[model samples]
Target: MLAVIRYTVPESQSQDFAKQGQTILDTFAGQPGFLRGRLARSVDEPNLWALVTEWEGAGFYRRALSAARLVMYPLMILMVNEPSAYEDVHAQDGT
Candidate 1:
């Protein structure tokens, strides 16, 4: 499963945004079923960012968020309101 949280950050706050994203990723790392995660900025729109996380499943992802709400609220509250959870129907690896 995948969880993608998008955010629109001003140019002035990009650095802080990246730092906060890293912190969130770090927090997720300690949770069960956290496969991996990344912090990315859109190439076409520099101010557009995403915190993408891969989890074992939607249940695991939801549990992680619910457990970390206290530590995550500050930045989590800034994410754009949209459907962020997804299931992988098909996946291919370059290798």
Candidate 2:
């Protein structure tokens, strides 16, 4: 499963955004079933950013969220309001 949380941040806040994202990623690393995560900026839209993470399953993602709620709240509160969970249907084999 994938969880993608997007944010609209001004260029001035880019550094802060990345810093906070790294902290959140570190917190997630301690949770069970966390595969990998990335903090990326959009090439087309400089101010757009995404916190993308792969999980073993939706359940794992949910559990991670519940477990890290306090540590994640600051950054999570900045996320765009929308559905963020997805099931992979066509990922490359062995990836």
What TM-score quantifies how close candidate 2 is to the native fold? 0.89
User: Which run of 10 residues does model 1 get worst, by summed lDDT?
Assistant: 69-78
Q: List model 1 lDDT by residue over 1-50, tens digit each.
A: 99998998889988888887888889899999999999999999998899
The superposed Cα distance between candidate 2 and the true structure at residue 12, in angstroms, equals: 1.6
Ten residues in sequence with the least summed lDDT for candidate 2: 70-79
Q: Judge candidate 1 at residue 52 and give its lDDT.
A: 95
Those runs of model 1 whose alpha carbons end farther than 4 Å from true positions after fitting are none
Q: What is candidate 1's CA lDDT for residue 33?
A: 96
Per-residue error (Å), model 2, residue 7: 0.8
Q: What is the lDDT for 20 in model 2? A: 86
Best by TM-score: 1
